[model samples]
Target: MTYSASMAVQRLFPTDEGHDLLDLTREVVAKELRPKVDAAEAAAALGEEFPTDIFRILGRAGLLSLPHPEEFGGGGQPYEVYLQVVEEIASAWMSVAVGVSVHSLTAFPVTTFGSPAQREALLPGMLSGHQLGAYGLSEPLAGSDVAAMTTRATRDGAGDDGAGDDGATDDPAYRIRGRKAWISHAGHADYYTTFARTSDARGRGISCFIVPGDAPGLSFGAPEKKMGLHCDTVREVIYEDVPVDAARRIGDEGQGMPIALAALDAGRLGIAAAATGLAQSALDVAVAYAKEREQFGRAIASNQGLAFLIADLEAAVLGARAAYLFAARLKDAGRPYGKEAAVAKLLATDAAMRVTTDAIQVLGGAGYTQDFPVERYFREAKVTQIFEGTNQIQRLVISRHALG
Candidate 1:
């Protein structure tokens, strides 16, 4: 009937700053997200609505850019700390947590692969918390295969014709014309971190660009009706001769594939953290219900059969958290975390699916009803396994690492 301010799960931070950051995150979650998530998600499911205000609230609080450089207006926290903050946010609102993750993903290429000049120019706005971003990687035809994207970026003559040897062009240098599918915050983002093919070469042909949201030929499709996470609006980003400056490109031409792949490794850990939070929320709700709901002559939780199920749910949530945290620590240490990121994503999302299902079972018929949030949690959990590289794709990634 009521959501707790905090769950029973214990957290340990590596520093006082980490502790303070989480405390700030919890304060924001309590004040900003918890009060509006239910009504917002319900309203968004019926029509086109996005919680731009909530993102603004997070942005103003410095929560949106926690994992980037401080000099660039980010919080400059380590990934481990950042992910825990995401988990805390997700415990109250999954959509916002996902938005945070997606926003972080959009800035990744610029932060990781951009030239010093690009970082100096772009990082200020991207990490300023006043702006939101969308990732333009997946297409309708190329969901998991980055190399299969057909979006093309042809060179414009503006740069070739006496544009100065310094690579400074007043006019656009490339025109991106293609559609990016399933882009979150499509119409609402301030910028899009886009990838498009620049040549005929299969994998090496792609290039990354930071496309302005209001580009002349850029447009969006109608929002897709979805089962859950309604406030995280998704639609097609149509780029029809969307002109981009030479400076907007994040990495060198023909280097988009490697950039995208590297970014995905970090993105997977974000989803894993969020899934764990969702599962933890479900478990908390189930536990509270089990302790109160009377059956026969006593509480349902008094029964060993049902009690064991709750125990298992706790374990699942813990394991999921641990998996993501391990991956986050690896990333923070500047170690190779791609395989571990895949493993964490695979384990945490699958755990989310199982734990949420069992939580509903723990509630019996009530969990299936809209009166409870478990049903919504169940719906949200299904997509985590599908996005950020599906579990099947994750297994393949793991297998490749194992074989090598």
Candidate 2:
């Protein structure tokens, strides 16, 4: 079953424009993404290959900037609407959907915490759909414990004229020196939203900076060999004495922890939505195969035992979708949704893992082969429980909120 047929899942939009945007997204998925995803993913798994053209196509279609403010080249769509678009994309291509989520996370600091001047100068390009971004928060030693990060950004000498190596003038620059690990689009992004320590105040010492991709001393390591979502391109981003103008900093010094946490809340929702889509696709394939595959001169779907399993998969996919949509609605209404986001991420990703695994079982011997997509879906679903904070971290967030 192709993604287009999987659109049988009913959806509700807050506005006519939202409905149209989804229609556009599905059309693009059918025409552009689904056609190329298998070939592209296979090529990427063998060597270095990033879907630069596909991103450009999405950018030009205005899909990349849907959640940002309209005043600065964004579509100004609500979180609920933007997330559905992400889910639709994920149904067709999981790697591209994850890329969209990571790109949105990279812009979260500037959109949510940047000063007026920063927004005016940077947002147009960032949200213009012409640029891609990477989030630089995790490090080799500090994946979950963000405060343990050793990346340092020191203020330049007082006597020096605040001039960048590129001859751009911005007073009071800072030199960043560190490495970020497990970064998506590490070598291909137009800019990196990076966090580094500036003081000795533990969590209060860090700050955020937007470093241009062309910045001197910014380099990337070879991509990590991963089990799935190979086209997403995970890598290490090395910042060796990279200079950034203070003007590029999103929030004030000592505010990075809050900024990063807030961004994760939103990022978690993205992951949840994507996971739901993936599960839906898996369920769709399983159902289609069950109806066609035969046993004892009858379709296997006629067997009550197999049919019950299909029903459970359907229930899990719908439950996951409801979980994320509820969280998205909370975020759209300007309410505190951190705990809900964590819950959604935990539920949806766990559902994805279960649904995809069952989908493979539904196909039996055929599923274990590359001839069917369930094997690939199983591989992709495993990582959803790991990234955007592990399901373990989600439980911690939910417990803290409940206790408080």
Best by lDDT: 1
Q: For residues 243-311, could you state the per-residue lDDT of candidate 1 as single tens digits?
A: 988788877789999999999999999999999999999988998999999989999999999989888
Which 10 residues in a row give candidate 1 its minimum summed lDDT? 159-168
Candidate 1: global Cα-lDDT? 0.91
Q: Write the per-residue lDDT of candidate 2 for residues 1-404, one digit (tens) a residue.
A: 43343588798999999999998999899999998999999999999899999999999999998999999999999999999999999988999999999999999998999876677788889988889999999999998888999999998755233222222454437889989999999999999999999898967999988999999989999999999999999999998899888777778788999999999999999999999889989998999999988989999999999999999989988888899999999999999999999999999999999999999999999999999888998999999999989999999999999999
lDDT to native, each model: 0.91, 0.90
Q: Each prediction's TM-score against the native?
A: 0.97, 0.97
Backbone clashes, each candidate: 0, 0
**Leading candidate by TM-score:** 1
Scored against the true structure, residue 247 in model 2 reaches a CA lDDT of 75
**What is candidate 1's CA lDDT for residue 283?**
88
